[model samples]
Target: MVVVKYLLKFLAVLLLFIEIDCDENDIESRVVDGQLVPIRRFPHVAFLRIVLPYGEENVCGGSIVNQFLLVTAAHCMDFVNLRRDSIWAYVGHENIDEINIIRSVKKKYIHEDYDPFLNTPISDIALLLLKEALPLHKTIQRILINIQFPSSKFVTEGYLAGWGLVDEVNETPTMWLRSITQELLDPRFCYRILNGRIPGTFCGGSKHANRPRPAMGDSGSGLISKHRELLGVMSVKSAKSPSVAFYTNVTSFYSWLVKTAQEALQSTCGHL
Candidate 1:
């Protein structure tokens, strides 16, 4: 079996604009060092269709952790409220255009300390409670969240996946899933480069020749270590040109995550 040790517990995709303090306008995120992969490779990863008054758009990415839990970045939920009937989760497909399983979102539990504009954005994490548990099988499997500190090796080398477009402004979205390998850079180094605006996150990106950073639509994508363990969720691409990006570290907020999810399920999920 292909043991993919990626990061995170339950990941859910959010379809909100990941605005950055860049000179250019309309910037989101896409795969940088990317290669197309089969939809079945990462069966646990999920595609999201966000329906708002504007319209329906397949704009975010996530992973399946257990039966009814979905994890993702807090920024994804920044613009949208925790209304139960608005969000839907898709599985058993890589491309958003094809047929797949769709489920409704029950409730969203955002971290109490999530700050989108803080000096470093503390506790940039959120959880989604699903109406139904994920169906696990050969085509769909649940991955354990990275609740423990990763080894030095896994942190330095990891894989990230997304369906964001190459050109955020002009290009169309990709029809299939894409995966890339990147190095995990120190958050302190990234802070110095970002001038202290980045926080509660880790830095990672590929060494592509022409930058080729992640596209704009992959705001809630997952970043997993080489061992197939989830390390973080895509948060921001600190650089203006989009070479490297920031992700909300999963381990740092592991304790709060479990407690929030459990409490949410008992007292909150009944409403949905």
Candidate 2:
């Protein structure tokens, strides 16, 4: 009887460890139900590699705004240790392993007002200034940022591409780029679902059941409109529903982005 009791206790401890492991893995790779993107299709999509102090690496997606600037989520920069850590951007390749052009990040400009502790943080954007300017080519280019606000009458769908996890059950991120079409949701409906209003953010997701939705690792990936204009940055995914996610609206930060980019370029390149 005592032996059986001890065995049961051991099993319980083992099960607890397994649960913790699964949770960690889930948080690390959180993208699902996306289709593989064609090579050179998403030229402006950047695969960011952030190396922490102890050699630990974190991955986030970003959009190439110009030769020297790339934009991502401010939260993605929260844990970065600039004194010891490093960031690298890989562009012009659909496959993560294939390195066509690599640029090291020289500066980080996170939105000053961003607060991650908020129920829904606004201004979750950040810009990374590369040490060297990226060369434009057939498979490497910059995406145009949309300055006009999106409306239901004009914008119905947006495209999201990233190298995040394609299978949550297996806990693995795709080596190749993947993309999915998400239907934009009404702002009122999104506010209701989130239980609050996030002024500089908007919501989008798959209308059909079991369709792809942006997840954690996809944060900072661009939400591109049909006309190839960047509309949003992947921000937060709904905890209650996998089919719902929020994005930091690019249009809301257009002036800030442009002004910041101009200043940074002038300082780095001596001209804009």
Candidate 3:
């Protein structure tokens, strides 16, 4: 009887994997337009599409930084097995043209504390170091990380961009840029939503149903303001209520970011 039970359980797990594979395969490919039409407005921004060794496609967003580093979410790392050939990180080009490839990742560093199970949002950030410096003069550059602590007393409005869905809930993701203004929700509110757990997480966005919000495949994308300062990384959404979404507060991770960037710079320019 135990042997039969184990067999049945194995089959169930296999079936679940199959379902998820199909769901990911169904992601719609829509050309980016609308708010994204003003490419000049966000010259430093870019998107990342992670392709698994098996050729499964999982889309996440990223930003260009300097000539070699790309910043995005750590959860995106879960999509591919580490043993697989190093995953590809396409930068600069949004359209499907092969000629626009910027540079490939020579190395990737995921936050050490990242938990695959909880998919912890607090540590849900990653950095990709390109093998070659991006052609900064000819190609656009990445927006610098927002280090200035915008006082919590002042509720600042921020913006996020991704190749995510267009509706309240969508299976197809638009290629055109979609953005919505979100007010920084207090950490207290975020803790309340999480039932007082993981206070490290911060919340944002309006409760208004009509307002556009981030959806699946939007993780690891850039959230910035008019100043072009990198703000937060789109992290979690209130599953019970999509109205409340959480982002990994970039300001909270400023020290780590600076340290990481400095180390990367030294290693890349070791000869200098």
Candidate 4:
């Protein structure tokens, strides 16, 4: 009788653990001060599923630059061991729970100059080569990368979409994609505000305070211009100022991106 009682206790504990795991999985969509994205509105937006070497999983956002290429922040690949880690990209869905087209990453290229230890992250950009080309459809399309550098005198606004944390306090990601309009601050002001931590080769947060800004997990998403051009890759948020987010200017690395993409496509061997 004691053996049977112990067995029941063990099974009950196992059931409780399973229930907790399921509840955690149900938590979703955490973009701060963002709204639900319309279905197929940002088709180029790709959700990356990254499994680290230690078996922990995380997510980052990317933009489908082409049928075979994805653009994201280089920091997302930091500390990842490709031999033991895995990455997958999901496209064509606003809700993560919905079925979407998925592709494995065959190659990853981080900028040669990217240094994670720097006080300010420059060249914080990376590209992933999909194992198979994504089929272009109404729900799956590529966004053009903007190579034109913005003038330092003017403030420009763009849209930022992601499935990052809703707020610092809540610390949870949303199940659905969310987005907000962010004003790219003037270069001179941005430099002063961020105290030279970020350079002009990057997009800084709005001059107005308390604006909706990208948070954790939003890194690697695209900063898109009004013309549907990808202007930057989400990089970092200011530690002192939570509202001030930084993005890697895509225009600064246009040449490297083109060369790397061409090389990645031509090579038969995978470059992790």
Best by TM-score: 2
The sequence of per-residue lDDT tens digits that candidate 3 reaches over residues 33-143 is 225544445555566666666667777777765666777788877755545645555544434243266566666777777787884475887777767665553335567
| Residue-level lDDT tens digits of model 1 in 90-126 | 7777776784677778777788887666645567778
Q: Which residue pairs clash within candidate 2? A: none
Cα lDDT for residue 52, model 3? 68
In terms of lDDT, the best-performing candidate is: 2
Better model by lDDT: candidate 2 vs candidate 3: 2
Candidate 1 minimal-lDDT segment of 10 residues: 13-22
Clashing pairs for model 4 are 28-173, 28-174, 28-175, 29-173, 29-174, 29-175, 30-165, 30-166, 30-173, 30-174
**What would the per-residue lDDT of candidate 2 be over residues 42-112, giving only the tens digit for each residue?**
88899898999766888899998877789999888876867789999999888878876899998998887
**Better structure of 1 and 3 per TM-score:** 1
- How large is the C-alpha RMSD of every model relative to the true structure? 10.5, 19.1, 16.0, 18.4
**lDDT of model 1 at position 160:** 70
Report the alpha-carbon TM-score of model 3 versus the true structure. Answer: 0.77
